[model samples]
Target chain A: DAGVTQSPTHLIKTRGQQVTLRCSPKSGHDTVSWYQQALGQGPQFIFQYYEEEERQRGNFPDRFSGHQFPNYSSELNVNALLLGDSALYLCASSFGNPPSGYTFGSGTRLTVV
Target chain B: QKEVEQDPGPLSVPEGAIVSLNCTYSNSAFQYFMWYRQYSRKGPELLMYTYSSGNKEDGRFTAQVDKSSKYISLFIRDSQPSDSATYLCAMGPSQGGSEKLVFGKGTKLTVNP
Candidate 1:
């Protein structure tokens, strides 16, 4: 089965700009979550999408938002990006509730100049 | 304090050695624990997961969870060079549909041949 897949493996954008990253969850999975991983750090949860609605969110600011399409694909949008936004954007998929059967994509490396 | 705490170790061990990685959490409500392995410039891949307290083994990897102490561990036996990567510990509450994961700073391991 195909694992979770993310688009634009790497991208560079200027500060104050906006960026959009995409993700396709693994087959048979319906929930999608987004995470941010800084260099030499573990990922921090951004938010989670289920049933096409954002269900839970982390401590991130409003500049970060996400959407889960009907087909279970997801998109993470970051507006007014700062240099600190330069990190690996990871997309994860799970069958239902997470902490089980969770899979992650290779992630999109966002570099804000 | 962070909900989860893990040593960001650049742990170097010779090949074929036994390696133990661990994380401690302050949240007792976290019922599901997971271990993820991430290579450089790549997203994390789930290595093992455990619900509540117990030990689960897959091949040379063993995951142990102690609910009373709120500690979790991942052990690798006969380690190989390919096992060199950052290991992340993640946990979430018992919610069924919209559980969000809290991750610890990853521990980097190097298995030198």
Candidate 2:
């Protein structure tokens, strides 16, 4: 089955700009989550969307926001991006609310210059 | 201190060797543990998932969780060059995938052929 798919494999943005990254969950998956991974670090949870509603969130600020669609697709939007925001944005999908194993996409490499 | 602590090891070993990766968490409520593999510029691929304080095995990979100690581990057997990648440990506190996953700084490994 097709796994999670992310768009614009790479991106470059200036400081204070905004960026939107897209993700399509795997077939039959119903939940989507976003994560950020800095260089030499592991993925940090941003938020999770289920049933088109954000069900859970991490410690990140409000600048990092996300939306889930009816088709189970998702979008991660960052506002007023800072250089520190430059990292790999990953989207993962699972089947249920408390999914056991999540499928991940190759992720969007966001570079805030 | 960080919620999850992992040694970001650029661990190197020869092929056909055994590799052990580990992570420790400060949260006792973490109910699910997972290991993910990621190559450069790629999203993390789930390697192993386990709940409870025991061991689970899949092919050449094994995962162990010690809830009492709040430690989790992933072991790769007969490693190959293809196994070379960054290994990340993630945990969820509430009902697994429905909640946010806290991740550790990945451990980079290079299996030399």
Q: RMSD for each model, in Å, please? A: 1.5, 1.7
DockQ of all models, two decimals each: 0.76, 0.80
TM-score of 1: 0.96
- Error in Å for residue B104 of model 2: 0.8
TM-score of each: 0.96, 0.95
TM-score of 2: 0.95
| lDDT minimum window of 10 residues, candidate 1 chain B | B93-102
* Model 1 stretches with alpha carbons more than 4 Å out: B94-98
lDDT of 2 by residue, B1-113 (tens): 88899999889999999999999998887888999999888889998888778999999999999999989999999999999999999988644334778889999999999
lDDT string for model 1 (B13-68, tens) is 99999999999999878888899999999889899988889999999999999999
For residues A21-103, write the lDDT of model 1, one tens digit per residue.
99999998999999999998889889989899998898899999989999999999999999999999999998854336579
Candidate 2 ranges with C-alpha deviation above 4 Å:
B94-98
Model 2 DockQ class: high
Top candidate when judged by lDDT against the true structure: 1
